[model samples]
Target: MNALFPALRTRTDLPALRFGAETLTYEDLGRAAGALVTPILGAGRVAVWATPTAATAVGVVAALLAGVPAIPINPRTGERELAHILGDSMPGAVLAGADDVLPAGLADVPRIDVETAVDHHSPVSAASAFSGAEPDDPESPALIVYTSGTTGPPKGVVLSHRAIAASLDALEEAWAWTEDDVLVHALPLFHVHGLILGILGPLRRGGSVRHLGAFSVEGVARELGAGGGTMLFGVPTMYHRIADALGDDPALVRALGGARLLVSGSAALPVHDHERITAATGRTVIERYGMTETLMNTGVPVGSRPRPGSVGLPLRDVELRLVEEDGTELRAYDGESVGEIQVKGPNLFTAYLNRPDATAAAFDGDWFRTGDMAVREPDGYVRIVGRKATDLIKSGGYKIGAGEIENALLEHPAVLEAAVTGAPDPDLGERIVAWVVPADAEKPPTAGELADHVAGLLAPHKRPRTVHFLRALPRNDMGKLLKKALPEALHG
Candidate 1:
């Protein structure tokens, strides 16, 4: 019932956002965002060209202030994917920066330049502007974020104010987040991790965020070392770069060593990189697990030393369980039995927008099936193996998780990057296959050697039967590996 960002009203003069050299205090943000609220109030649903800039944040904030559902479209989205999102959401208008060149798909929709709106209404106070607005409702849809849609057209996950607030609050408890903490990151703005948590999380806590226009180790070092950023959030790829750079850059080691928290999400932080960073900086990067359908399910709590492979315990109020194939809940947390993760919590999206069938299928009673597979430890830690649909490989009567094999392959000195999948074999129902980007292309490790490396680390059955070497593994914008996009030739 209360405003999502309470600090916007009370903490008027404190620095709220920073993108490169530009900075906006809480007062500046409120006025700029508040000016756009009137125009966005009655809009059925607004689409934001979610670029990583002040305008994008302002536009989304304005939509939320007016209680209108805001759909964030990724700037780098391909034409076909952009078309699908525009057609699916049917937004009444598109909000973008003053100079942004929009695609033809958005040509039919009305355009709103967020900068011009702010300039035209500089006199408006956020409090005075929102005074006449409709009362806040916790259950109202706040954001409609689209999934990666690896299988089909991306589905819009309808997130409510309740879900967003609960997620942030739960994270506040877990991470010891507060207004004094300054967060820094280079994640894109369209997804929940970057937009909701990276941006909105700070605003909700009345904290500050310093966003690097693009990710660079130098930028990370500068921000944390001198810019007063207490926390850093990034995907594994960015951290991998940091891990690689730490050995050569003392400033980076010092920057990361001094930070209060370093969080990694959007993909698994390979244990190799994790150990590398920790060994260099004496800081363990906290990893959390979630999907667009659920804002957040689990995270490593502050002051707790995390296990190398675990994502930590479920956050406050989130009910999590590992379930068998037949939907039977697994009670043993021995850390070996793998099962699909099913969650019941307030930090969950209401439904898949415009797809009742998908909305219905996503839920098993009150629990939302996360499609992610994991093993639970006796101490309540959750170590995710992979996605049930793509990462779960049934090979030779054993249910093998591609993630564990990928991690094992990464442990080998010759492997720079690795993705594991199953391919059909005449003898075995499916055989474990490893797609590798070798550390040395000219003298790559042989298939037998790599397989033997994995067998030495894990069981023999978990070793790769086939190994394909590549220059690079396919990855999405957030550094998540596109396992489905791997070469068809390798499978054949």
Candidate 2:
């Protein structure tokens, strides 16, 4: 509530960020961000060409300082999607890095090029000082983050400064995240995981961060080993790559094993990868649950051993509940019964920009309907089943979670990647189908053998009725499996 970041007013001389070969001290960042304020002042909303660079970070910070809403545009976004976002947000201006090439949609908007280097041999004044105001309004929208709309067109989710503050505070409390920890990752800067948590999270804590430009096993190993990174953040695909290479490279094993914390998000990290990483390095990767609307809801407490396929407990101040289809709450944490996730807390988004009907429908009373399915243990731990629409396979009078069968299939040594979906059937209502990428291409395991492996681990009914083999599963930029793309991928 006290201006979102108190560290900006007090901290200086700390290593603020390291991106590629560029380095910045806290003072440098303050000045660089402060310089940007005058150029983008009085803009109601601004668009950012969010490339994974120092300029993007500076632009976002500058927008926040000016108390203007910043909408981050993915660099690789298609022109069609870009056009829609531009038409929707109607930003007053667009900010991009010095060397960035923007799409045609942004040609009409005023453009401000970001400069990362600025001499600041002195401390920076409070951001509120520039506007001649006491402080920015906490409830005012700070960012308009977009969701991957599998249900419909992409919608802009407005996040207030208060929401961002609440989430980061809860995360700090839950992870014991201190200013002394140096965060490291190679995630894209457009998304919440990489933009807010990876970059801004460190800045808010008065800590430093190192970005690898792109993810590589070598980068992760080298950074943690000698780059002085203490905490690591990545998506499942990044971790999956590390897990796959851990046995061959002792450096990767030693790097992960020696790091203080390793957190995975953006998708479910396969249980097989978790066990493999832990087996080789003696370190357990932490999994946390969050969406674009909710910054972060739950995480495995820092020191606790992460349960396989579980996202652990709700974060501090986040009130979570599971609900039945009828909208009644499921109060018991019996661990076997599944329900849709409903949340009530300060971490909730303000609105889905310009969509009152969607925003109103998003909440049932004070709780936001998350559309995700999960089972909660008696101890309050959460095991995500899957999404209600895509993953909840109701077949033969049994509610089968595709995630469970996916996990079971991953346990088989021959299986590389597995995704499950339900197909309509005349007799059973829906039949469980498995799409897999085998570890061995020359001689892939038969569908019956994979199904048998699942049956042995779980119930027989949970096994896949049919199998489809592919070279790789379709995924978005953040590594989330695209279940809706399954039908199209099958024919491709």
Candidate 3:
């Protein structure tokens, strides 16, 4: 029930963060925050757009410490979507870099140029005024995160301090993180994966983190080989590229070997990539399940047997139930049935800001009915089938989760990324279709060959009936497959 920044400021001399060529101890960061807060007093909400660095992290912490809600908008979003979020959040001021593009309407707001803010000399002031007051009641909104809208326009999810605290505490307990641990931080700050798990989670536990402004396979491998960090969190795509870059470096191998844990999320990992990573790193990549709404629900246990292809059990204080198509709750002990996943826990977001209708529709009493389909194994492990109705491909009376076919397709040597959708067919009600990104354009696999490859690994009904090769697969801002957009793109 304590505000995070205020609590951390007490241990001012501890190593706080390392980014690029810069470093900031907790004391320096607290003072920097105090300086930033001085001019922005009474600003209820502040929007920030800065280069992903220690400065940006300090800015967010500074805003929180000042009792101002911080909204970190993605720099690459279209002006239209950017304007919508700004209008909705109604920020009192904006902190943006000179090079950052802003919506046309944003010029009217008070601006704090980030380029000049970070250049100020060491802040010479007491940090007490900036320390936020006692925990905003557990349900009071602390952060607003926008999820990529598959159903409609994006909506802001209001997360409370208690919700975030629950997630971090559960993560630390499940993974056994200690103050001595150092985390590698290269993921985007706009996403919960990086903002919460990558930064806040480690910081809350007194652990150190090294932040990377961007992800480059060669650059990241070099950092890992240097061996200062002990844990890595990345999306599946990032892991694939990093594994490929390591090739045969003994130092890279040793660094990966030394890490306490390597985590993957955002998208499901192809079993082929998973195998390659384990072979090269000697560490099984721990895949966890989460979304913008629920920070994190489950993860494969550290130092225990990692059940391959499963996301592992629910974290401490997380409760999960699987419901059948008939609206009946499926027994968790049943080994053969797959059902929709509904979760209720302290870590789940309270509601979508300004979207009371969505808040009402997303839940059933206390449980938030996550639109993900999963099956619980006899051993208490849960393997994701994929998203609920939207991602379920119906072809010739058989229902197949697109993720499964895509996962199988990725195992082929030539396939780089794959998206599966149902295409209109004359004979079948809906036909299985796949759009793929090939690693080698000069030697792309034929539709027949790719279909055969998938058929060899899957049942005839589950194999993709048609295939098309593309330069890249489409993904939303958060790196989730845009299945609804696929049918249009495929036919367009």
Candidate 4:
């Protein structure tokens, strides 16, 4: 019965969640979630208004308690994407906070307003006896998380209870996690990094989480300095802000230095941020790699030495392998040979919901093609180069990774953020073009200077042939640079 949330009932007296001014004890959450059983049970699928609110957490937890497949819709999704998700997932009901105003597209779906209260009490059920009804099969779909539609329309990834359980358990083991650990993050509730890992990871271990509602450097310092949080999780943007503010704030330096582990994911944290954080706080920021299809494939274990930009070893029970472009498996772990990563494990989603062809294409035999390009160290640690389609740039006589050159540009004091892409050129098959956000717009570094910086770190051929300056790089809610949407957003 406790397969999905192993510690839901057992962690009764412990403080379970805090978002802004609202707080919920484990006991309080149990009753609130229990009350939702009647409404959610028997419903095959539901939708959640994924806002950074306490009610959003309650609604998701309630759906999990009732064994219903919950599809979390990003609150900021565009009209077209929102329409696509609504039509594709076709959830029976949509759960929203009491204050959320329904969009015109969601007018047809039955709406359930989740109460934001957390102090209501009820008799604590036995750990084995909680809930409305348990799914007879653990393989029943628990969540239908939609993918980021970079190539085409977004597809719903069906995650079963068994997959969710395997993922959280493996993370617990990898991080040496326990109930004593207090997690802190201000990420959104729509994606895996925020919803599954940020929310469910702590609950599975009977631990506590303090959600900041929204990320801010001040919020981070306030919580870590006096909030008693032992571990912190964030995307690269959040870390970038922290790194930028560290030189001016002593409290931030102390708070970050005192934490047990600092994790960065969703997108790679620039190597410069890693160095800045380490230099200021003596804390090595850890990075992990995963996607919507696979909750978590690899991470830096709590006690391990963090290789600055590497995502570290594959998690417990996850098997990761690198394959060449032609699909042959690469057996050598030389730390420099790059290949596409394919994973096989219990932590993968069952299939892309309702798309048989898409589901079939995602897997080869038993391994799921991750579409990410990376190299493996001799010690089995993995280092991601970039994605196969967009981030792999073949220029001149060399195949280069855009992520490496972007990191090099970020290392320059004049650059704030950088994204590298390939543009067709007559000389070099596809030349490297960099989109840069300068630290100081009025005194921005010249294109030649930034190109020289990349050439200095990497090679002469790997440097960007042209540079375009922007006020800010277009990014999704999860801090992933929307490379596909860049031209439309930047040029037009």
Highest lDDT against the true fold, candidate: 1
Please provide TM-scores, in order, for all candidate models, with all chains considered together.
0.97, 0.97, 0.91, 0.96
State how far residue 132 of model 1 sits from its true place (Å). 3.9
lDDT over C-alpha atoms for residue 116 of model 4: 55
Candidate 2 residue-wise lDDT at 44:
76
lDDT by residue (tens digit), candidate 3, 1-492: 136643365566777788877777766666666667766656777877645777667767666666566777776767777777888888888876555666676788888754323323554432564544434566666678777655667798888878888999888888998787888858888778988888787778877888877876655555555847888888877887767866766666787777888888877877777888788877888889988899999988887675656788999999998998776999966544678899999999988878899999999899898899888888788888788766666678775777778888988888988888777778887888889989898999888888888888987787778888777667765566777766566566
Count the clashes in each prediction: 0, 0, 1, 0
Residue pairs with colliding backbones in model 1 are none
Summing lDDT over every window of 10 consecutive residues in candidate 4, give the lowest-scoring window: 120-129
Clashes of 3: 1
Candidate 2 lDDT, tens digit per residue, 1-492? 136555676776678889989998776776787777777776678999999899989888888877888999988888888888889999989999889888777889999999888755544444433444314578888899887768887899999888888888888988899999999999999879999899889988988899999889999999998788899999989998998898799888888888989999988888988998889989899999998898999999899965878898999899999999999888878888889999989999999999999999999999999999999998999999999999998999888889989989998889889999999989889999999999997879999998899989998888899999988889998888998888788788
lDDT of 4 by residue, 102-171 (tens): 7888998988888756444444343423544767688888889988887889999999888888888888
Candidate 3 is scored at a TM of 0.91
Q: Name the regions of candidate 2 deviating beyond 4 angstroms.
A: 121-135
Pick out the ten consecutive residues of candidate 3 with the lowest summed lDDT: 116-125
Residue 410's C-alpha lDDT in candidate 3?
Answer: 86
The sequence of per-residue lDDT tens digits that candidate 1 reaches over residues 1-492 is 137988988898899999888788888888888888778776799999999998898898888888889999998899999999989999999999998999887899999888723343456877777775734578999999999888799999999999999999999999999999999999999999999999999999999999998999999999999988899999999999999999999999999999999999988999999999999999999999888989899999978885777899999999999999999999988888999999999998998899999999999999999899999888889999999988898988888889899999999898999999888888888899899989999999999999999999999999999989888888889998888878853454
